[model samples]
Target: MISYRWLLFIVLFVGIFATNYLAMTVKEPLAASAAFTLMVLSVYGLEKFYNRGPEKVTDERTDLINMKAFYYGSLALIVTLMFEFIWLVSEDYETAVLMAKYLLMPFGAMIAVVVLSKAYLERVM
Candidate 1:
């Protein structure tokens, strides 16, 4: 029997292909809507699969490793976002604000969450 992980992989693979095909052939607004919807649903599925516990889906050690990896990934995302924001600011204040609004805050939030979670986990573990 195919595992749920493989099922999730298959769904995401198909979603990516469908999104690419639809985006190229469809109207921009429709394509954007479709992509957004697909992304939301994909994330929902992933969250349900990975976030719930006691299933041996992953152990405490694995979770700690994953959290550590997330912390690093968040760091990278925030650093790149800051550089982008600086470049945007050099270009124009209005553009900088617009770009930073979409980029910096979300990345910063993720970094904070990951860093704190990793710290807490390390302390307890």
Candidate 2:
């Protein structure tokens, strides 16, 4: 049977290709490609970390760490959203519409915070 890791890798590869292709069609292809390369490397490193050991069952400590990480992540998301709201409020309609493309930034920040906090908590506690 196919593994989840392979599936994730395949999806990421497809996304990378699609992103680069679209980026090449845009004006700043070089900058986009550089950013994409960095993102790919980061994902590859994370994949290596995940596959470094056999999967383990979650325990009580793990649960506690995740809960706290989630709390911190949610707080970050709230703060990010507040900033986004202020930016939107201060902009004209056209500018606001343009900035709306970054609506996912807060979600991305939340995910990053959650992942980083969970890793730190695991090491500390």
Candidate 3:
């Protein structure tokens, strides 16, 4: 049987991909937001299912791995944002909000991937 963690990973990856694709193709905020909402719900549900109720003990290794992943992911996001800012400034762009939103996509995706990986490893190993 496939683990819940792998299911979550697949859901998140597909959701993000579909959201971005729809955002680009349809250019509809509502559609993109719906896709994002699905991703968030899946993650939350998996967390609750795995760590709460009958499963009283939380996985320490999963937590540690998630923390480490988050740290590195955040650092990389910061660096990417800095470079994007530099590029935007060089190009004489004045849309700070837009730039921030653009940067958020990758950052959010990275966090999702990290969390999914931790959950997957926890279940498999």
Highest lDDT, which number?
Answer: 3
Top-down TM-score ranking: 3, 1, 2
After TM-score superposition, the amount by which residue 38's alpha carbon in candidate 2 deviates from its true location, in angstroms, is 30
In candidate 2, residue 108 scores what lDDT? 80
The collision pairs in model 2 are none
Tens digit of per-residue lDDT, candidate 2, span 18-114: 4444443443444444545555566668667668887669888878787855675576665455444434433344555556567667568767877
Q: Give per-residue lDDT, candidate 2, residue 84.
A: 47
- List residue ranges in candidate 1 displaced over 4 A: 42-116, 119-125
Clashes of 3: 0
Runs with alpha carbons beyond 4 Å of true place in candidate 3: 54-125
Residue range with the least summed lDDT across 10 consecutive positions in model 3? 84-93
What's the TM-score of each model vs. the native? 0.38, 0.34, 0.46
Return the lDDT, model 3, position 26.
Answer: 67
Alpha-carbon RMSD to native, per candidate: 9.4, 10.5, 9.2
Q: Candidate 1 local accuracy as lDDT?
A: 0.61
The number of clashing residue pairs in each candidate reads 0, 0, 0
The 10-residue segment of model 2 with minimum total lDDT is 84-93
Worst 10 residues of 1 by lDDT: 23-32
- Candidate 2 ranges beyond 4 A from true positions: 9-59, 68-100
lDDT, candidate 1, 54-116, per-residue tens: 766778787875675666566566545544544444445588678867866776777677767
